[model samples]
Target: MRILLAEDDVSQAESIKAWLEMDGYSVDWVERGDHAILAIEQHQYDCLLLDRGLPKATGDDILTHLRKHQHNTPVIFITAQDSIQDRVGGLDLGANDYLVKPFSLDELSARVRAQLRTQHKGTSQILMFGSVSLDPQAKVVKLNSEIVNLTAKEYQILYKLMQHPERVVTREQLEESLYAWGDEIESNAVEVYIYQIRKKIGSTMIKTIRGLGYRMNLDQT
Candidate 1:
């Protein structure tokens, strides 16, 4: 799953980012609430790990913006506030979960997975379409009981495409999801990755929409 982590403490943010990546999640880390808001505005994330006392803007304010704009991405407020009223306030601002400071990495990771399940409408962690089964948590893909080897980009492209199954995923969306904010992106990078994924998963698994982009072949799976 893709996540946006909004925490001002550099060490804490890096530590969380490292573990989330190790746990098979693609994470984008930002220290300021403004950056977090910009990231959310420009891209989509499975969840947000937000620190309430953020500089430039507060986490609650950011969550309020998300709610006001109808961005339903799940949010987990990580703050030092541990009171019931504080928790209620966070929840009222649309946070799906709340974590007190000095919490365990294990607990945070577990919460992230839980939020991901919610994002998928509580679907099983094992994503499926026909004979293909994808375990996003383990970064594993199985095609008819056979393991499919894919590069990082290939897996990301396929994962992004699979998230919406039959719906078309535009080239811009694929590109934004695949890379971070400042990476030098190639003009044909999305197409190249799509081609590579098709070669591995089978040409018929993805359909190109003349000007639109690609979608998973839902008819077969």
Candidate 2:
């Protein structure tokens, strides 16, 4: 998953970023609220880790602006304030979860998982399309009960396709999901990944549209 962390505390940000990255999340961080907003506007994110107090703009202000613009992305306020009123205020401002500073990394990870689970409308932990199953959090993919070997990028493509079974997720959208800020992307990277996925999974599992993009063929599933 992709996440945006809006925090000014250098040590704290680095710690959280490193931890989340280790947990298989693509994380981009900005130290200022305006930069956070700009990042939000530029790319898609699975979640937002926002600090209540920020430079130039407050986290509440950022959340308010996002809501005003109809961005329903899940937000977790990572702040030092842990009072009753403070918690209520953050929730009222549309935060899906809240984590106070001096918090355990495991707790933060748990809350993030919870938010993602709630965001997912699926009824299963393993996303399935026919005999193929994917444990996203575990970064594992199985073809009919047999574990399929996949590189990180290959897993990313398959997971993206599985998430939107039969739906056409454009090349640009897939590229964004596969890459983080400042990461170099090859022109044929998407095609290469698709080829790798097809070789690992069944060829019929994915279909390429001439003008559009790739779509998972779940009808046979």
Candidate 3:
């Protein structure tokens, strides 16, 4: 999944990004709330980790704009504002959760997972396609009830395809999910990952639509 973090603290942002990336999530960060707004407009992020105190625009302003436009992306306020009133106010502004700074990265991860679960609704986040299953929180993929070893990028690509089994996932969309700003992506990087994924999963599961992109074959088993 993709997450956008809006924070001005360089050290904290770097640490959070590293931790989330290790947990198999693609994270893009912006130090300014204006940039955060731009990124939100351009990308379909699964969640937003926002700091209320931001340059150019406040996190509250961004959240209000998001809600006003009816964008339902989950938002978690990760700010130093620890007062009950502050937390209440943030939640009132449409944030799904609130986290105080100097908090545990582990707890932060748990909170993110909570928001994701709520977004999925009905208490289950498992994604299934035919005999293949993926646990986003656990970062595990299984084929035929057996574990499948896959690189993070491969899992992300497969997850994207599985998320929309009947729709074509374009190469650009997959690249956006797998990479962040300033990351160097090779010309044939997507193709290479797709090839590797097919070998690990099955050859007939992913169908390449010429002149377009790829789609998951729901009928494949």
Candidate 4:
């Protein structure tokens, strides 16, 4: 999953970004609230980790603005404030979860998982699409009980497709999900990766929608 982290502290942001990437999440870091807002406007992120204090705007202001505009992306407030009033205010302002400073990376990861599970309405860690099963937490894929080894990009593409089975995903959408900002993408990169995935798995699993884009067949098993 892709996440946006808005933290002004350079060292803390780098540490958190590294930890989340190690846990198999593609993350984008922003040092200011305006940049965070711009990132949200440009990209579709699974979640947001907003520090309460920001350079351009406070985290509460960002959350309030997002809600006013009907952007319901889940947010977890990460700040030094650990008081009851602060926590209650955050929740009241539509934050999903709140984590104080000096928090464990493992705890942050667990909270992220909990929020994603709630957002997706999934009770299990395994995501099953036909004969293919993906363990998002573990970053593992299995096909018909046999483990299917996949490169990071291949797994990313497949994960994006499986996340929205039966819906045609445009090449631009796939590319955005697979790449971070300023990353160079070759022409026909999506097609190349798609071909490689089909060769590794099965061609019938992912269907090309002629001129539209690509979609996974819901009946594949």
Candidate 5:
């Protein structure tokens, strides 16, 4: 999954980014709320971890703007604002969850999971297509009951494909999911990952569209 963190505190942002990355999420961070807005416009994120006291644009402003434009991406406010009214105000502003600072990393992780679960409500977290199966929580993919070893990026690509079986997933979308700000992307990076995935899971499983992108081959038996 991909996440955008809008936090100005350098040390705290680094720690949060590292922790989320370790949990199998690709995270992009911005120190200013305007930069966060630009990132939001540029990429699709699974969630947003926002600090209320952001520079340039406040978290409340961003949240209000997103809701005004009907952007339903899940957002969690991670701020030092700890008053009851503050929590109530944040929730009223459309934040799905709120975390006061000095919170445990474990709890933060759990809250993120909870919001994701709510976002994907009624959809099984374990994705299945044909003979392949993926467990997002476990970060494991299996083919015909056998484990398939995959790098983090490889798993992310496959996960994207599996999420939309038999539907075209654009190359740009896949690239966005795999890379964060300032991460170097080779021209053929998506193709390389696709090549590696096919080698491990079987080539016929993913199909390339001549003028578009790629899709999971649901007819692959």
Candidate 6:
């Protein structure tokens, strides 16, 4: 999952970034609320972790602006204020969850998982297409009753495909999901991965749309 973290404290931001990255989340850090707004406008994020106190703009201000602009992306406010009024105010401003500072990393991780689960309407962790199942949290894929070992790129490609089964997924969409910022992508990189997936699973699983792209034939048995 992708996350945008807006925290001004350098050390605290770095620590949270490292922990989240270790948990297999792609995170972009911005030190100011304005930058956070810009980042949200630019990229699609599963969630946003915004500090209540920010430079130039406060987190509540950002939340109000986002809601005004119809951006319903789930947001969790991280603040040093532990007062009941502060927490209630943040939630009323459209924040999905509030975390007070001096919090445990375990609790933070749990909150993140809870928010994602609720935001996706309980569709964030596990994805099922026909008999194929993918556990995003565990980064595990299973076909029928057997566990299938997949490389990083392979898992990402498969996850993207399974996320929207029975629909055509163009090559460009797959490319964006696989490569990061400035990573080089070969012309047939996605095709090579598709071939690998078919070899591991079954050629009948992923159906090509001729000149279009590919789709998982989930209805087939």
Candidate 3 local lDDT, residue 102: 90
Clashing pairs in 4: none
lDDT tens readout by residue for model 2, 1-221: 78999999999999999998887788898999999999999898989999999998889989998999999899999999999999998999899988988999999999988887777645447888888899866668998899999987788788888877868988998888877676688998999999989989888889998779998885666
Candidate 2 collision pairs: none
lDDT of the candidates, in the order given: 0.85, 0.88, 0.90, 0.87, 0.91, 0.84
TM-scores, all candidates, are 0.77, 0.83, 0.90, 0.82, 0.88, 0.79
lDDT (10s digit) by residue, model 6, range 34-67: 9888878878777899998999888988899899
Residue runs of model 1 more than 4 Å from their true location after superposition: 122-130, 133-140, 145-155, 163-168, 183-196, 207-212, 217-221
Tens digits of per-residue lDDT, candidate 4, 33-144, equal: 9998889888988899999999898898889888998998899999999999999999999999999998999999999988887776643367788888988766789988
The positional error of residue 64 in candidate 6, measured at the CA in angstroms, is 1.3
The lowest-lDDT stretch of 10 consecutive residues in candidate 1 is: 116-125
RMSD of each: 3.4, 2.8, 2.1, 3.0, 2.2, 3.3
Assess candidate 5 and give its lDDT: 0.91
Q: Which candidate would rank higher by lDDT, 1 or 4?
A: 4
Better of 1 and 5 by TM-score: 5
Off by over 4 Å in 5: 124-126, 135-140, 218-221
Give the higher-lDDT candidate: 4 or 5.
5
TM-score of 1: 0.77
